[model samples]
Target: MNTAAFSSLPLNPALLENIASLGYTHLTPIQAETLPPILEGKDVIAQAKTGSGKTAAFGIGVLSRLEFNRFNVQALVICPTRELADQVCKEIRRLARFTQNVKVLSLCGGVPFGPQLGSLEHGVHIVVGTPGRLQEHLRKRSLRLNHLKVLVLDEADRMLDMGFEEAISDVISYAPTHRQTLLFSATYADPIREISKKFQFKPITVSIDSSHHDSVIGQHFYQVDKARRMSALGYLLAYHRPESTVVFCNTKRECQDIASTLDNCGFSVQALHGDLEQKHRDQVLVRFANKSCSVLVATDVAARGLDIKELQAVINYELPWDPEIYVHRIGRTGRAGKLGLALSLCTEAELPRVKAIEDYQGVAAKWDEVAPFPMAYAERFQPPMVTLWIDGGRKNKLRPGDILGALTGDAGLAGSAIGKIDIFDDHAYVAVSQDSVDEALAWLKRGKIKGRSFMVRKSQWG
Candidate 1:
């Protein structure tokens, strides 16, 4: 089941080693079925849910076609969101870990264009990005598509659902005429099939978990009054006190309201919706994924490619119109060899939707009563100990170790005194204990990391 097993599938020894280093001994169903055709240079259409190992499925094939010495963009993976682009690029980088000079760039909107243009100018071998920004780069001549060998449209249906058809088609039209077109999605409706027909040439199709069966997740039903659903959610959180949880609402506004209510109740919580600035959305996700925030309230679209490893539970604050969304939401948990809990707060009016989910799963949910939420019966908002902002990150060759060394060395602060450190593409965020905020700031102002100075400032969480 190791990379050695896949060695006969026409991959190099270095790639095999890289796969081993990534702790992937054997391929998942998606990888096993899709890798061979892709490695044989055939176009593939793969359907798999999140965390089903599709990233590595296509990543290996893309990396196998690359020549380390060449700097041209050989493979272009277009993801629907910036977060997804970043995630895909990270996976590609890992698959190409042993190879020297494998430069993977993620181009997305809301990030600084200047840096991306500069990176493109320097040269890149693989590019992963969102449709709009990729098209923008192509128009500006910053991203050339002539050398493209493989074109991957990840989350293809989501792109169509999000109305990225024009942007995706535009980017595709610019790519070379004879390139491999690979499309990956959770479901392949007529729209995706039509796009495949238009763009892909007799591609091989691989479907895993087509029924969207979710067995690992423990389903629980919480019956509450229409007005007291929020109270029931609060009670469940206090009762279970899961390490991390995502509460899904039917609308963006409901997500905001729930997050605000939780924050007011003294919980480390954040809301992810379409209305927030991209930067804030990124920060909210980082906080929730890193356990800096205990709860994340989000709409389905905003929560779509979120892969939190230790996610303990999922709460259906509002029932989705499509019962399939119920399966996708709960599937986020009960992953990576851990048990997951899926709870739904249902009112009398939503009985049909609730029944649909239960019938689909072929299992009945255990009903529960209104238990006491030993939760924070607290009053109002309290300011955090200290907010951190780092103006330098991966592009600047900055890392957590360097930041830690700088803070402890130049700032003369104890390691335990630092609260949290969240690193992004061009910036990082660190939190210092309230007691040492003044000293940390005063010292960092004069200190340097890797002999280079960066702008460090307090964060505005509100």
Candidate 2:
């Protein structure tokens, strides 16, 4: 038997079958190295990047030790952002599909508290959530982890960067010290070490090389004048014309300014930063992920927990002070054995940062000159999809299938015309091909979804 195969692990037969059903024949490097210790019910600290199958590794461990009969929360996975928390919950649910009556809930802020409270009342075996909301529930006595068997701090470095150390410590204080603890982070910085020393008991450290290989991600740096930064960015976008790209900025203001400039220049763009309202943030993220938006301008802090698949390129409008952050930013792209592009613009003042990155990666910086491009080239770039927002969502018992059926069956549109359909609590968003937007919107307005009329309109970004 191949040691890299999932069957090599001591997993339940049903779980093995389910893993196979999910098309996971072999364990990812992170999973293969950490699953043994995780299954053995031991404390493990694994340093792995996003999209490394870490979620499945921890999700499997949580489910393997879950007590289905018991209503108490047996496993708690703390994440840095609500987006990440929701993603973790979804992955865990998929992993637990083999087992019946295994409850999993996501308790994140930016949504109604009453619903979370109600879910807690009904009982859940696994809870994946952020720090603030979890702290609120713990304070209200609506959530209790006295029976927690396994505790996981997913993206521990991001959590610490978001200043959730106190809340994480507080949440851990509620859990039993005798239980197993697992910490996963992309970078094992000093703070990460401190977190492990403070919480984990003699944790088995597992570090996977988080660095990107030169063969995988093509790194290019262009020297630009500070005043011509916006022009440089536009030239890059016009040059590459990536269908999906993320432009990483170093500040919230810069993030917004770059997004606005690109939007004015006729590119489908949105900004993600700490200052945006939660609803706006959701819209920005949904539009970007669904391909309705082409380029996403975001600060590192705001880009935490972003897991976009098949991202073509990553642009650093301004280099981060830390090389690890550069690695984390570029790591978002070139995932799953796909080619990735990392482009950077550095001014004379920032050349030192370039040297730092080169020294850290142990590779020379590849320099490229940005040739002038016609301004009209920017106008030619547009997203292939347009998103429509429906007034009703999960709260009104709406689902993706209902939206799809309405478009295909009643709207007389082919299924291929529709892209990704995302259903939220009070609203839903569906991506329609650019050619089908008008028809889809017109039909959605006159027609009914699930036999109920809904206000529908094309979503727009500022």
On lDDT, the candidate that comes out on top is 2
Candidate 1 residue spans exceeding 4 A from truth: 1-8, 210-215, 372-376, 379-387, 394-396, 406-421, 430-448, 451-462
What candidate 2 gets wrong by more than 4 Å, as runs, is 1-3, 374-378
Candidate 1, residue 128: the lDDT equals: 95
Q: Between which residue pairs do clashes occur in model 1?
A: 2-25
TM-score of each predicted structure versus truth:
0.88, 0.97
lDDT of 2 by residue, 123-220 (tens): 89999999999999999999999999999999999999989999999989988889999999999999999999999998999999888887779999
Cα lDDT tens digits, model 1, 118-146, are 89999999999999999899999999989
Instruction: Assess candidate 2 and give its lDDT.
Output: 0.92
CA RMSD of each candidate after superposition: 3.5, 1.6
Residue 65 of model 2, lDDT score: 98
Q: CA lDDT of 439 in candidate 1?
A: 88
